[model samples]
Target chain A: MIQGNKKKFNVREIREQFPALRQLIYGKNLIYFDNGATSQKPQMVLDAINLYYSKDNANIHRGVHYMSQQATNGYEDSRRTIQNYLNAEKSEEIIFTKGTTDGINLVAFSYGQLLSAGDEILITAMEHHSNIVPWQMLCERKGCVLKVAPINKKGELIMEAFDALLSKKTKLVAVTHISNALGTINPVKELAKKAHAVGAKILVDGAQSIQHTKIDVQDMNCDFFVFSSHKVFGPTGVGVLYGKEALLEKMPPYQGGGDMILKVTFERTTYNELPYKFEAGTPHIAGVICLAKAIEFLSSYDMEAIQKHEIELAEYAQDMLTTFEGVHIIGEAKKKTSVVSFTVDGLHPFDIGTLLDKQGIAVRTGHHCTQPLMDFYKIPGTIRASFAFYNTKEEIDFFISAVEKSINMLR
Target chain B: MTLEEKQQEIIQDFAIFDDWMEKYEYIIELGKELPIIQADKKTEDRLIIGCQSQVWLDSSLENGKMQFYADSDAIITKGIIGLLIRVLNNETPEDIAKVDLHFIREIGLQEHLSITRSNGLVSMIKKIKMSALMAV
Candidate 1:
């Protein structure tokens, strides 16, 4: 376990957990700033994956043998672990998915397929394509109207516009809890309340939010919450979709297959229980097991303390970036995550990203899959450096120095 | 064109970046290589909606092959478009469809591409491929 002292979250110790962090890029220690895309997995998560495949590999649930029981136990145990992590009402509410994209698609297909024409689905101006496209597809297919709530010039959500958009016709409200492109921490609780006031169910895309904040679906009053495990230092190909039991039971099964059914019949078939109904075929067993390990790793740390450390790093980065002559920071909302999106004058973002890569700093450059938001902002893209709990202030200094050098070189 | 011929052409053009610091000069040089679209052809139809630079791409099929002509108002973007055209232009629809382009990593270009530029490149590729498929 990492020590709780202020300096105990050493970059060396944190980097040690992620073997990839030691890798040399341009003969320098890799400073990964692309955590917004996907986080690097720790050795513990890797070991969990290896252990599962090496020892406990078997078909889960149906088999009566020892290996089967072990596999089943590992899989179900992960569900319980995640349920506790999210403070979900029950393990049945935790449905394993491929990732945030799959989770959103599942809800859109299941809950969305049920909506009639003239119903409205409200999403915000700043949503990842995964959140926006699925709902758009749903509205397009179901003859429902898709309405967007606007945002301010600062990339903050316009609450009044959101309020005006909400009506009794609004069947479902799907919005991102955190803007992956802008790093804005949205008022999802307020959005949820607004949706529920109009008798509309809400789904919070928690992919970016879950990493930086502690989430309680009950407290937020969101009907569904979706997040990818990869964004939270867990293995790729695994995610969680937490739906209220009543909502899960009410909606149709997302996909048809073996595990999702109660019984096989030539005439008629009934779907299985809450989670299994959404989980079709053989799921990502190893990834799910490792996700539990990641959740365990996060639970060990004091979340408030970690958040404080990250905020400090973010503020330092913001200050350092402001010193650069041509640098412009995007997304200056009062509430934000540890993402800093900036554009340097005269240097294209791609050029900046390339030069940064040479300096062993990995930052995401471009629109970040938020083309609509980019269109709204009227910029091609910004070089984005999103921080994780494991990042350090020294790394930020190195990053700022690199940016300064890069800007100078480009100039 | 044969793969060898394409390689030769790219190698010949690669010297244009000998002085990387003179980016504006290289960008202007890249702009010169870009084939011009007719003034009447300039329309909202040709404008790539997401780019900060005013980029216009137009395509035509000849002898069952797709050909692309693109220009960008921003100089470096023009160079990027030229880079893209070097890789993608004149390929068969089937060949273009199978090209993984993970080789962008080999040439060390992906690291240089911002996610948006990467996405724009992807969107451009997708559009080009769609046009090729239409031609086919």
Candidate 2:
């Protein structure tokens, strides 16, 4: 459904599409600023979820019944939608999994099989634990060496250090396109070029970048890209892994199950073709179909406008936060998305967070699953307010006042 | 006051507040007034396991009565700890172990009591009970 006035981007109209945005929390209008964790679903996606389970529910890929075929078509069409979104050359390269963590593990377990001892995997200091732990586990299992590139105090990757770390021994360079805890957008395209120069393949963890920017795997020349549907206004339990066709064909199947087998015999077993080789059980069918609706919902708006709006919100919040006496902004990268993390002198993040909760403003406060980054900053945790496109300056205004009140109460 | 009487008194104090603001303001004040734990008692063994804030709780049995002291990095958690100690301090070990902390829920601060809340108050309460049981 076209929202009908595409000429000018109207955030209010876009906000209307999300039912969760129109509600009350503790008698105040809910000001949700936790988008970096997950996004609220548009009504279209919610409706699609209900429609799929109510009408078209069936096991996909092997049944000859009408419902099964319809379910299969919806699931495949969703793959094509994601393929077009990421500009992958073929739909066969899109492998659906549980989410970003699952996608990274698939590469670690399957692609790790091809690596021999003494091979190296290079990652950055700012990667989320999901990206770091998989490589460590792979190293433990395969005897590959794990190397980390340093980031400056500003939370930006030190290109000199990254360059020094990349060598011929490096077989894989796994990094996040954007930092979840710091809102730092890494130079993935440049990093990809450098990795290729060293004869190493790069995997871009797009968990934070997919919703905020345009992604073209071919344009970026990344060997692998992964993102979660829930972070892009879709349902949870579904994710996409976009790998180069040649690389995917070379890697062994991730999981062996009913759908991932071409034929099984007592003597020998052959794996199914490209995409199916990775998808094991009956997948999250309703979630996949609803994710397509989410992508469609996102496609209706101007992504550039959304990106601009989100950046404006973050900048506005950061500038307001800076005016306060003891508020210290954590990440001040040259290019950042919709995240403002900070610490206050003589105040704990958990205290501030609890005070904000009483006032009906939702923000995340903790280590944010980046303990190494927290330790680098020499702080326990931070109070983070991450915005989405549907948010407005009005919500930021309320959030700022809430923060002030919370600080006063905390002090 | 008896333990049940102390709980009733706290409930009455909270009932006077019209909204969450007034209640939180009082809690923050209580948190600010919470006594600091002795430096020597802040050992790793006394640290609670599940809270987002680091909470150290120490207890002793003096003359068959329970004596509890606690501290936290967060003021709100400190205030909540103040409430817990107010009711349980100086009670008998059997009473400390057997008493239901209904006052937490009665005062509309039940979120902290939830098992999913990582603030470690639940763990602190459990530890207090385990200590009380040991003393018994």
Candidate 3:
């Protein structure tokens, strides 16, 4: 019913697609600026979830029944949906994962097994803990060197320093496309090209980028890309790992289980083909189907216009909020997405968060899983407001005033 | 007021404010009233790690009654610590160990019970009881 609107990118009609936006918290309208954490699901995605469980519910690839065939089609079709969305070379290049963390862990465990003690795995300082810890664990397991590329005070990666860190010994480079806490957009295409020049593989953590911007993996030329479903308004517990086909074929299966195996005796077993080998059991079938629906839901809108609206909100909010005395805007990168992180001078982030929460404004506080980045700033944390396309400029005005009131109250 | 009377009084104060904004204002006021701990006592050993925000609690026994001093980076957390200290400050070790601070839930601040906020509060309570138990 919501999709019946003919006007392109009618945000009011688009906002109607998400039922969660209509609710009230603390007797006030809920202003959900936590898109960095997770995006609200659209009605079409919800309907798709209901459609899957109600009809196409069965074990895929094994059962001979009609339900199984239908279920398999739905799952594979969703894979194609993601393949097209990412503009990947082939559907086989897309592997279903639990989330971005699971995708990275798969590469770390399987691809990481090939590395030796002297090999270096490079990452950025502004990465979320998900992007950092897996490589750390891989390093500990293999005795490999983990090098960190530092970011400047503006939260942009220092490219000259990054080039100094990259070497022939650097086996892999894992970096985020956008900083979750800071909203800084890294130059991934250039970074990928540089990694390739050094004969190193690069993995782009697209968890923060996929929803806000257009991603063409082939154009970016990154060896692997990872993102979560919920971050893109799809259901949780489902994600995509887009890898170069050759790299995926060479890497061993991530898990040994019923679906991943072709045949198994006591001693040896052969693994399945490209994508199936990595996806071990009965997957989050419902979630996967809804993810495609979410992508389709996004495809209906003018993505560039939506992106512009979101970025404008961030810039506008930053400009307005910075006017408040004692407000220090963190991560003033020249290029940023919808995220805005800041702290009131001499006031704790938790205090600001608590006061905002009282006003029904949901902003993320604390280290935001980038404790190292928080350490870099020499602060406990910053109040982060991340906007989605559904959010309006009026909400930003409300948010700025609420923050002003909150800072005043704390002072 | 006695510990029980003090807790009852605080609960009554929170109950009057239906608006969350006002309730937080009340909590921030409570935080302002939190007795400052000495700079020397703010040692690493006294800090409670793994709180959503940093909390430092200093606990001791004086003449068989438990005494507590605490601070937190978050105003809400400081106020939460303030509420706990106000109730159990002058109570005996036996009483402090067993005291039920049910007013947290009764006052409609139930979100604290579900996350690390509650964990931090639990650790705070555990530290108090541990101090009391050691005295006993």
TM-score per prediction, in order, is: 0.83, 0.97, 0.97
Q: Residue by residue across B1-136, what tens digits does model 3's lDDT show? A: 7767887898888878868888888888888877657778889998886545777889777887878888877778788788788788888988776777778888877676566554366677778888888887
- Quality class of the docking in candidate 1, CAPRI style: incorrect
Tell me the tens digit of each residue's lDDT in model 3 across A339-404: 999988889888888789889999998889999999999998899999999999999999989998
Q: In order, what lDDT does every prediction score?
A: 0.82, 0.92, 0.89
What is the C-alpha RMSD, rounded to one decimal, of candidate 1?
5.3
Clashing residue pairs, candidate 3? none
Please name the candidate that would achieve the greatest lDDT relative to the true structure: 2
Estimate the overall C-alpha local distance difference test score of candidate 1.
Answer: 0.82
Alpha-carbon RMSD to native, per candidate: 5.3, 1.6, 1.9
What docking class should model 2 receive?
A: medium
**Which candidate, 2 or 3, would have the higher DockQ against the true structure?**
2
Q: Candidate 2 regions off by >4 Å?
A: A1-7, B49-51
Which pairs clash inside model 2? Answer: B51-B118, B51-B119, B51-B120
- Rank list by DockQ: 2, 3, 1
> How do the residues B1-56 of candidate 2 rate in per-residue lDDT, one tens digit apiece?
99999999999999999999899899889999987588899899998855368889
lDDT score of model 3?
A: 0.89
Q: A278-349, model 1: which lDDT tens digit per residue?
A: 888999988898899998877777778778888888889999999878788889999998999988776668
